[model samples]
Each structure stands twice: as C-alpha cells, then as structure tokens.
Target: MGTSLNIDLTAPGARQLPKRTHVQYAALCFRIREGKVKVLLITSRGRQRWTLPKGWPMAGLSPARAAAREAWEEAGVRGEVLETCVGGFTYTKRTSPHPHMALVYQLEVVSQEKKFPERGERKQRWVSPKRAAELVEHPQLARLLREFHPHLRKH
Candidate 1:
C-alpha cells in the first residue's frame, strides 16, 4: 500500500473566499425647525464615537422598522420612517463580533421624550446638519447628511 496525504479542502485558507457579512439597519433621525435642520446623533457605548442610531435587524419586521426602534431606544425619540430611503452606505464592521453591512435610513423625528433611560450610557445630541456632517466619524453617513440637506431645509 502506498502512503497518501489527505487534504482538508474546507480549511479556513484552503480557498480564496468572499468575506462573510450580515446586514444591519440604522436610522438617521432629523429634526427640522425654524429653517434649521438638526440631526440626532448618539455617542456609541462601545467606541464612544458619534454616530447615527443603528443596530441589528429584527425578525418579523422590515429594515425601516428596525431603524425606527433603534432610534427610539438610542435617542429617546419617536419618528415616522419615510417610505423612501434617503440613502445607504456600506461600512466594514471591524469591532463587531461578526462582519456586517449597515443599511442606513432617514427618519423624521416626530416626537421625543424629555428623558431617556439609557441617557447615562449614551450621549445624544441634536446638532446642525452641517455640523452633524462634521461630527459623525463615518464619511458615508456624512455624505448622506449632505444629500438630505435640501429636504431637511424645506421641512
């Protein structure tokens, strides 16, 4: 009998493969008043970087629905999710346990509570649209803020 070497083809680096990814939904909630457009941003609990309210999607609900829920939970604001998506951008999840692609949405802030339960954990701010663009760390999100500037101005 001849000795033979058996290779495991499914090994991690056995083949060049596409990176695995999951989809995460996020909400960019804006409050426009007196010709001034302000965007709600949250300081992440983990990274402490200023970013829009977002999280993983939920079962039995649409992406927009998940965005709405995240907005409420993170910012203590309730909003109406527009039928149209203002924009979307992809971001690599370097810190998340699993790799993810975030689908961002625009939500109109209809109402808000005086206090948020997670206020201690997260810092929320309503900043000018232009300032928001500068504040958020994500370039893609900043672009979206600029894209929505016209609509935000009118409202």
Candidate 2:
C-alpha cells in the first residue's frame, strides 16, 4: 500500500519561503573631533549614491576583516574595526533577486590617504552623524547612523 498527501501553498495562510539571501559586511568608519563623531561616506560606483564602505565576504577573511579591507579599498581608510557587529540592514540589488543583508561594524579611522583604490571612481566625505544620516539613501542605514554612539576615549 502507498499513500500521498498534498497541501495548497496559496490558500491564504502563512507559508515558508525557500529563497536564499546574500550577506555582505560593511564598515562604518568614523572619527571623533571636539567630542562630536563624524562618519565617512562614499559614492557608489553605479548610482553614485552616498553609502558606507561595504562589500561581499572574502575568502579566507573574517567578516570584520573583510569590512576593514573594503574600507581601505573604497575610501582609503586605515582603521581599527570593532569585531562586534553594530547592526544590519537589507536591500535588494538591481541584478539579483536575492536581497542582501549588510552587517555593519564600527571602525575608528586612523588615517585617510590622499589617493586610494577608488579615489578616481568615487567621492568621499566626512560629516557629522546627523548629516550622514540625512545623506544616505537607505532608511535603516540612516537610522543606524543617527543612533550611533561609540564609547571611546577622545583623541
């Protein structure tokens, strides 16, 4: 004897999705001056949108390390990246159907070079957190920038 069972997926009930989501790591690089925190923002290559330094995970590199590398590559930033994730945000890419979740790590910037890998391709800026919040396109990222507070000794 054999038995078979079937269920309607679109019967107006909760259903589980089998979709795959991509993950990227990002660096929220910042420097403190006069007790105010300023964050670095870079222009995206395609749309030229203001955004943080972020990229896909690299082979043989940890998430935080990959984010630090992205910071260096995108904005000429050499900094200390906190291993703990500050927060995450999701966005859909133009070429892919899967949404990408970006995990953000706080990086205390040490130095920014006059020339970097993406210098000719993008514009960079350092602005107060509130200003940065206003500049970025993503709402969640803007909120993260708005609520950011790093507890570190003043330099």
Candidate 3:
C-alpha cells in the first residue's frame, strides 16, 4: 500500500481544479480444472478481504509481465499471458488515501510452483468461479468471475 496527498495548486482563486492522474495496475489469474473453474485469489494481509493477486506495475515491466510476477509472488503460480486479454475491470482504491483507479487484467494459469516467497503472511486459495464471486469483495471482480465461468467450463 502507498499514500499520496491531494494538493490544489491554484494561482489565485481558481474555480475549477485540474484532475490528478492516479493509475494502478493489477492482474487476475484463472485456473480451470475438471469441470470447475478455479481462480487464484489472495486474502489481503491487512483487510483480510479476498482479492485477485495484483499490485502496481513495476519499472521496466509491461502490465502482463508485472502480472506474471505478481501471480508468482502472491499465489505461487506460474502462468502464461495469453495473446488475448480475457477482460479488464476498474475499481476505486479502498486501501489508498487518494482516490485511485485499479486496472484488473485476466490471465490464464499455465503452471504453479510449490511455494510463495512474498506472501507468507497471507492466505491463498483456488476457488470455484461461483464461490469466487461470493468471496471477492469487489463486485466487478465477481462479475469477471461470472463471465469466465462459461469459457472455463469448455476447457
């Protein structure tokens, strides 16, 4: 988590203020097994809310690259970034003081490692799409899970 302060740099008495840019990057990894679709979700260490493994994009890394790193760090999964993006959803930042938008990407899990190095304090779970929708705190993520259900069933 990070913090940013909102400073209004007005010349004198400006009626309208310029909008500040706040960008956040995130990724979602979905794994399908058998007839059920399972997504790797991590419970936040502080809030204890279940969410997709995501974070700010790292320097010199593309969104997809950052996503793969995040998935490995948070969920102990090694996945492939499909040529096509499954979908994306936006949500306001609840953890940050500043009002920021979080961009979520859908990634497919190709493989998984046995251990997670960074998220020792947090709990990771592979949940069914239906169960995921109910467990995630964000409605948009829940909708994403729903959208993935039909496609996952086919695989």
Candidate 4:
C-alpha cells in the first residue's frame, strides 16, 4: 500500500519526513469464540517478540494473498482474508535503520494446522484483542488491534 503525505512547505525550516522505504503485508488473524474475539499472535523468529504474521510482497500474489500466505507459513493459520486493509504502521527493526510499513488485513481464521513451516521456530498463542495489543511492541499496531472489530456481514 502507498501513502501520501501532506507537508506544509511554507512553515519555517519545514522538511518532508522520510517515507517508509520497505513495505510488508500482515495478517491480523482472529476468530470468535463464546462471542468474544480471539486473536492469534506469533513470536518473531529473531527477537521472540509477539507480532502479526507478516512478510515482504510476493512476486505474483496480491497484498491480501501475500498476507494470508505469511499467516499460514508463520502460524499455521488458514482463513478467509478480507481485502479491506484494517490499517498500517511504520517501524524500524532493531537490526536495521530503514523504516518499514506494514499493511494489515483481517483474517477470520478457519483452522490452524498441527505443523507448519515456522511451527518449531516460534511460539504462538490465542488471546483477546486487547491482550494481543499489549503483547506487541509497535504502538500503531497495538492501536489497530485495540480498535479492531469483526465485520458485521457474515463471511
């Protein structure tokens, strides 16, 4: 996803902030149980920090499809991916100086496999959306999780 900035050039010493040079697509995997939203969060491979399943764009997949693929690969999540992006956030990894923006799509999870690509490499858990927000480090992503609501129309 592309973002546009509205800068005021007339302001004294005004300058444009650097755009996010790296982009990733992510899946906010969730399911409703007992009338409550349960979110699935996975730990990062290197940092062990909780986060959504995300990755760089794939050559031929659409953004939502790529996000779905990441969810499956990273967390064994198989679901219905909504093309409507819930939100996006920018952050810089501890290992790199470049800022990365992640476009997030909501995935209403159908099932989770017993084994998947990253199953042994990372930890996964199911928590409330608020708890999911608390477990993640990025404030913007946290906010997105906190504010997330299921689509009223059935899938």
- Candidate numbers sorted by TM-score from highest down: 4, 2, 1, 3
Can you give the lDDT of residue 71 in candidate 4?
A: 98
TM-score on alpha carbons, each prediction: 0.77, 0.84, 0.72, 0.85
Best by lDDT: 4
Per-residue lDDT of candidate 3, residues 32-126 (tens digit):
68856677778877787888777776899876677777778877777665423454445555665554445555567877777777757678888
Cα lDDT for residue 43, model 4?
A: 93
Q: Mind giving the per-residue lDDT tens digits that candidate 4 earns over 91-144?
A: 888777887889888888999998888889989999998999999999998988
Worst 10 residues of 2 by lDDT: 1-10
As for candidate 1, its clashing pairs are none
Q: What is the Cα-based lDDT of residue 54 in candidate 1?
A: 85
Q: How high is the CA lDDT of each candidate model?
A: 0.73, 0.84, 0.65, 0.86
- Report the candidate with higher lDDT, 3 versus 4: 4
Q: How displaced is residue 89 in candidate 3, in Å?
A: 4.1
- Residue 79 of model 3, lDDT score: 61
Deviation of model 3 at 136, angstroms: 1.1
Worst 10 residues of 3 by lDDT: 1-10
Better of 1 and 3 by TM-score: 1
